[model samples]
Target: MKIAFPATGTDLSCLLDGRFGRAPRFLVVDSETNSYQTIENDGNADASQGAGIQSAQAVIAAGATAVVSVHFGPKAFQVFEKAGIKTLQADIAPISDLMDKFRQGVLPRMQGPDKAGHAG
Candidate 1:
């Protein structure tokens, strides 16, 4: 599966950006090939309107099947759900370390969709 992570910087050692739309860069990592690509955020402040939805759309456009981040806006979570992309709250560690944690099954799978009115 492929995953996208909103990162604070260009490297995998960077922390995950907490704000989806405002993230400096997005790391698109392919689990199968262990390759990655980075995309910069070009949208302006107006992008904050429906930021979650917009971020989710960007991730999908990057061909991500999962999202690994520190947090996700409620609306963004909904978009992930609709897209059938897995979302997980990231540990407070480097993005590369987090990826390793995921591979090791140390990170827990996110849960919420089962509840009525589930949001981030």
Candidate 2:
């Protein structure tokens, strides 16, 4: 399974970015191999509108099966749900620790967006 984490840097040691859509980048990790690729989110990072939708589309295109982030807007949550991608809530932590929590099923799965639309 490929799990995506919103990150402030490219490596596993990077801090998890709190803003889902506006994250600087996304670290997509291969669970089996422990390898990862960083997808730049600069486009959405500065977007004044539709950042959530755009970011969600990017994640889908990157083939993420699940996402671990601090929050998701309503629109992004809907997009992920429709795409059959799981969304999990995670507090700010290292990418490695977040992945461990996800692997252990300790992270909470988000049923819906915790915040309103267009929240940066």
Candidate 3:
């Protein structure tokens, strides 16, 4: 499965960024092969509005089967649900550790948006 994590930097060693829309980058990792790709999120990061929607679209385009992040806005949550992508709530941790936890099925799936829309 391909899992996506909001990140502060490009690599797995980087800390997971807590804010989904404002995250600087996204690390999309393939669990079976451990191969990954980094996607810059600068456009959405600085977006005045619709950042969550844009970010969610990016993840879908990146082919992420799941997402691990601190939060998702209501609009973004709906997008993921429609795409059949699962989401998990994770605290700030290294990307590697978060991936491990996800593979072990220890991370909790998010049922709804943790905060309101456009919350930053």
Residue range 42-98, candidate 2, lDDT tens digits: 999899888989999998899899999899999999999999999999899999998
Over 1-120, each residue of candidate 1 has an lDDT whose tens digit, in order, gives 788888888877888776565577789888767788998776721463665567778888899988887667667778889889988777566788878877887766677533222233
Residue 102 Cα positional deviation in candidate 3, in Å, after optimal superposition: 0.8
Per-model TM-score, in order, reads 0.83, 0.96, 0.96
Clashing pairs in 3: none
Off by over 4 Å in 2: none
- Worst lDDT 10-window in candidate 1: 111-120
Point out the worst 10-residue segment of candidate 2 by lDDT: 111-120
lDDT for model 2: 0.91
Please give, for residues 19-112, the per-residue lDDT of candidate 3 as tens digits. Answer: 9988888999999998999989999999988898999999989999999999898988999999999989999999999989988999998999
Q: Which parts of model 1 have CA positions greater than 4 angstroms off? A: 44-46, 113-120
Spell out the clash pairs found in candidate 2: none
lDDT of 3: 0.91
